[model samples]
Target: MARCPKQRKKAVIAAVSAYLELLFNFINLLLRYYEALESEQEQAVEHVSSWETPIARQLARNSFMRCIVSHGDISCTMLVRMNCRTFQKLCMLLRDEGGLRCSWNIEIDEMVAIFLYTIAHNEKNRQLQATFRRSGETICRVIKLVLRSVLKLHSILLRKPKPVLHNSDDPKWKHFKNCLGALDGTIVNVRATKENQERYRNRKGTIGMNVLGVVDQNMEFIYCLAGWEGSAHDGRVLRDALIRPNGLKVPRGYYYLCDAGYSNCEGFLSPFRGQRYHLKEWGGRRPRSPEEIFNMRHSTARNGVERAFGILKMRWAILRETTWFSTKMVTKIVNACYLLHNFIRGENGADVFERLYVDEDPDEETEDVDEDLILHIQPTVEWSDFRQNLAQELWAARSWITS
Candidate 1:
């Protein structure tokens, strides 16, 4: 088995050569496997992209959905929705007065359309996102921004309650020269958590918010107080309205015609409790007494507030539906609606409704004045005498009618 030294050396060299060749082969195989994996990954990426929609096409679709033609469809009903020209005026106010043009570069027309659509249809944020071709976040942000902007116009939109001059010769208002306006409360449907449902429920067994409002002769809201519990009495709500810093303020010699739910105090005049007060009850017959005549006239004047509320509810469906908003937010929205109602009435006049009152068109049905629900506040001696004297004056003014 002994070999020559040269032969042993050759055999060792051969084994070494074989081991080196095997290591080189394994390295080449690994390099080829990595190259194949990278090629497969590139192909998968290309396949995925081939099925994707083009960015330009998607943008075109969004533009078509939010085009001017779409807005025209909205404008068709803008009169009943936002009382006609009010929608345009509101957008101008936000863009110019509220500084929205500087703060947010969103289109002013689109902003107004979004806001009115929300109120008129009572739409949710997600629903608006789809309709406006905007993201949910943008829809929410725009709504909040526009709402605050509209509220900034509150001071100017709210008209100051002015007294009728003694020498004024307007027949419709000459009879009640000292009257400031009509005051009343209306129930607006709302939504709340189960724990708070009982507190928000009214006598009608529905969740609601009690909204107290005062409207001038032109059907413009002078003062609005919202957020009261639905279960609270109308008189209690009025008391709270009086205590607020900007609450109702009746100047001396000016009174508001209210319903039986309010106290017949010096600043507020209510109809005779035991007598017929509604115009329907009179039914074309002459009043039997001075008190009956006063009640008839009081009912006629106080109807301004009811007509305002009716038009308001008809314009904004949000007031009629149960909104999925917190009670506080709902209150703010209610206040915004009142301010907008005043803005519309001031800008467009009182043509929002064809016949606001039942008496205006006897064929039209309207809200009846509730004379049975009496607040138990005892009238002051001076207050009682003032009402009695007012009734006598109204009766004495009948010389023109009788003649």
Candidate 2:
């Protein structure tokens, strides 16, 4: 039954040869992987060298940095929100000038890319991490670090209003008083959360964000109040603005316009009864007299506030996002947007309202909100000599309250 010696020897030799070949193949694969990693490192070094040159990392981001920095430092998240080029230059400048410490070891671009993809779009952080191959905590760290950087210059950036209307007839805002601008509030739609459903419930019976803002006659946001819960009354919001004595200072002889919800005083003004008693019990539906015409003019002028609010909502549609963020962060986000708006506009780019303020007629061809329809708009009196006289006649003149 024994096999031939030549046949057994041939089988043993074949098995040994196969094992040797497999070992060689595995060794080749490992060598190739090392070579690939080396090449990647060389490419990274080249990229950093190009960016390190005196040449701007990104002109747009650099320009934005230059502009905003005049006021103070800005956040990296905000910088990332800048155009790609802008972010590079901004980060470069921070490395060069800010003496800021970078906590994440990744290149500025990776951090910028992650945040840019986030706030600019409504994508979740998890999706961003997958696409960019980053961890959740790293993403969170970069965002917080940038916001903290931006907050440092808050004093210089978020300052009190000074009457820049240096002259009564200055061409700039043309005779607007101690007023930095008119103050007002609006509601943004939000999603209801289980814990705060009852709290954020608006009159429309849906959850939403309520924001209060102050803008100049030209529609530039001078300040804002973003922390109030949506369910808070407008009166309560106005009162809060007053309480921020150090926060929002309305210079003497300056004032903010308000609807009836606000308590009328010297620093603030409201229209006479106008034959209409209140919201539910307003008078018959029509503008019948000169007083009504005056009221129409008053409401027409104040519509600027509505226009400003509309632009803000339009700019950051995410304000309409249903998810909840900490109220504190939400407020900062709102301020950040306001500052950015002024930043991008680059000096009067968005001053249509300001132009409309002093002009008797900017758009003659477009019909003024149908005169007949004007009846529905409420009346508000300017708190100048006219307000004083009207108040005197009604014996409701308020002399106690002063700005």
Candidate 3:
């Protein structure tokens, strides 16, 4: 449609203006839609956050802590495996000596309580998160943190052994003069990679670590060596412990009573091999010979280590079960258990677990000591003669008493 030049130009200008107006209207509509969407998104975020407000979380945490603190000794003891007084003292010691500080959202007591609850119950991170009202990450971090703090107290918590004196009147210990304590090895289950599992497997076909524990007559741990493979022999582990710079220290002329798994060396006293060495075997019968009497007394004195191990396992459920933590962490947990055991024994008067679990008669069966395996230290002639002489003295003393 050819028209006059001025009329065509006016029509073209009007059409262009109409198109521009339409474009502006479309842009305005899009801007309004985007603004409405952003407002809705903001409202949705607020709604989600309102479900767990800071005040609400704080209240929940406070309520949980109040239940632990206010509820009597049974609640605290069952949960943390320690009475309220001991738990509070432990927290104070950790804060003052271990340098554990309260975090922004958590107190030191709460952190320690979390760690104790986890170990006492062998709880998983998810379980801890639900119980403590924390995230898994937070639970993991605090567990590790509290673990490290407890470890720092090893030097102070570990008891120093006092050798049995010459004039000792305790019937069980009086015979073994200059004896420090009893040392033995036990298997503790651990989780390892498939590649390393075979190395950790013990003769019983269990994947575990061999833990060497030395306990005084009072059933307090004096020294502990952990992390050895379960396949390791008790003597081999003891040798490693002796050679290490910070290993067990046995004074000159003093010895530790050991099971027949160890050699009768200079500083270790083991019962006569091929003889009745267990107290159960001596039940309902008097000693028929010097060796039997000596063995009976040795068994009585050395059973303290067994009781200590039993109490340790009974108190800490983590030790009884296979730990799911890494191998390194499991070792630390074992050490922590030893430390706590000593602490509890020293601090708590009349331990309820000890009263309940420790058998007064101690009729538990003993494993047959391996007589064929070569030990790190070969049996010494002098030590053997000394044991014979000691047996004779014990038999003579008993005969005099009967006479």
Candidate 4:
């Protein structure tokens, strides 16, 4: 049964080769399994994503910046800074909440992007609309719709005047005795498009928009009107302040402040005539004395309306002009901006003009009694005369009622 040495050696070599081959095949199989496991694990991670909200659920800047810019931040193109989810929500709100959608199924982001690019940045609608895969008409409609929503939601953000709280507490505004808010006029310039050039022309002899706004001491817009033609005076505009039955509210003893553009008629007040815009003019070497220094301090505090206008116009360049917004939407856009301004200030601490770098006048000139230029003053109603007449009527009426 013994075998030859050479044959045994040959058999051993064959076995060794066979073992090496088997080991190689086993390693290959393990490699394939590991690769498949990795693939499966990746698919699982993709499919089994955690359902909870991501820590980075930030609101898109557009949804927030539009409001902020108008009342407070006064920045341009806040759209680029927003998150995708928030951008989508804004598109949905404009489309769904505001019901502004066109035939193209243009999304909210595209629409908002169009506005931020066009109106806020003063880019042509055709150019911006094209970038977003939308038509110019769609862009126009989108802008109008947003303006409408802004107007619709203007009062929603207003902090109700807290009369119950004492006047001494919130020095930012005028409380109980009188003063609902501030009143002011702003001109929104527009290119004289041939279609309705005359209709848009204002007293300034330019085709522009005239808007009247009322804001509280906090600079929150309480009410706004945008329909008046540019030629309308501030007096006529103020008369209609109490017109809107539901949207407008003015409690008794509450009034507003405006410049000489408005009459000091029954419900409003202005600086004393021969009044210098800056009361410091009174002490100057001018012929006539001006208002006291305290008046300047008070007027400056009440002049938030001018600040609001500057903020709005500077941020949304279109606001400085007659917006292509529909006439009805004109008011809404204005209201919305004011409302959002307030919202951003309250929620985001947005300061519209500070961002714009509004400056104080160091050598600004004030009118000192120009003799050649006659000062037209608003006729005042003597309180004593008015009250005596009112008292006589009351006494006579009482005797008649007694009888």
Every model: Cα RMSD to truth:
12.1, 12.7, 9.7, 19.0
1-403 in candidate 3: lDDT tens per residue? 7799999999999999999999999999999999999999766444334327778767777887776778888888888888888989999999998889898888998999999998899988766766777777989999899999999998899877687878889878999997889999999999989999998999999999999999987888889999999999998999998877777877656789999999898889999888898878877778878998899999999998988898889889999999779888999999999999988877887677887786573201113222333224557888899999999999988844442
Local accuracy of candidate 1 as per-residue lDDT tens digits, 1-403: 8999999999999999999999999999999999999888766453334325556434643464344335553453552354334556777887777766533435666776677678878898766654655666877777777788877877777777755457756444556776777889999898878988898899999999999999877778889999988999998988777666667776645677899888888678898889999877878988767798788878877877888888788878899999766788888888888887877666665453534433362101123222332223457898888888878988887654652
Which pairs, if any, clash in model 1? Answer: none
Task: Mark the regions of model 1 whose C-alpha exceeds 4 Å error after superposition.
Answer: 1-76, 83-85, 101-105, 354-378, 399-403
Worst 10 residues of 1 by lDDT: 361-370
TM-score of each: 0.75, 0.57, 0.82, 0.59
Q: Between candidates 1 and 4, which one is better according to TM-score?
A: 1
Which scores greater on TM-score, model 1 or model 2? 1
Top candidate when judged by TM-score against the true structure: 3
Sorting all predicted structures by lDDT, with the top scorer first, yields 3, 1, 4, 2
Overall local distance difference test of candidate 4: 0.54
Model 2 segments more than 4 A misplaced: 1-104, 107-117, 130-133, 159-176, 189-193, 271-290, 347-403
Candidate 4 lDDT by residue in tens digits, 1-403: 8889999999999999999999999999999999999998766444223322323112233344344334332232253222334345455656655666654554455556555556565566645533444445766777766666545543346555322123444433322234555678887665555877787787668877677877666666666777676777776665665555443454433345667667654445554454466534546533222233324434664667777777666656667755554555555555566655565455444353546645541101112222332123234575224323433443443322221
lDDT of 2 by residue, 1-403 (tens): 8879999999999998999899999999999999999998766444444344334345433544344334232343243333334456645543544333555356554554444445555466665544444456877787665555544434434434445345645333332344445667777655555898778788888776678887655555667777677899976776666566444555445556655566556566554454542322424444444344334333544555666676555545556565344556666666655654444333323333333433442100111121221111123454456565643433332223323
Clashing pairs in 3: none
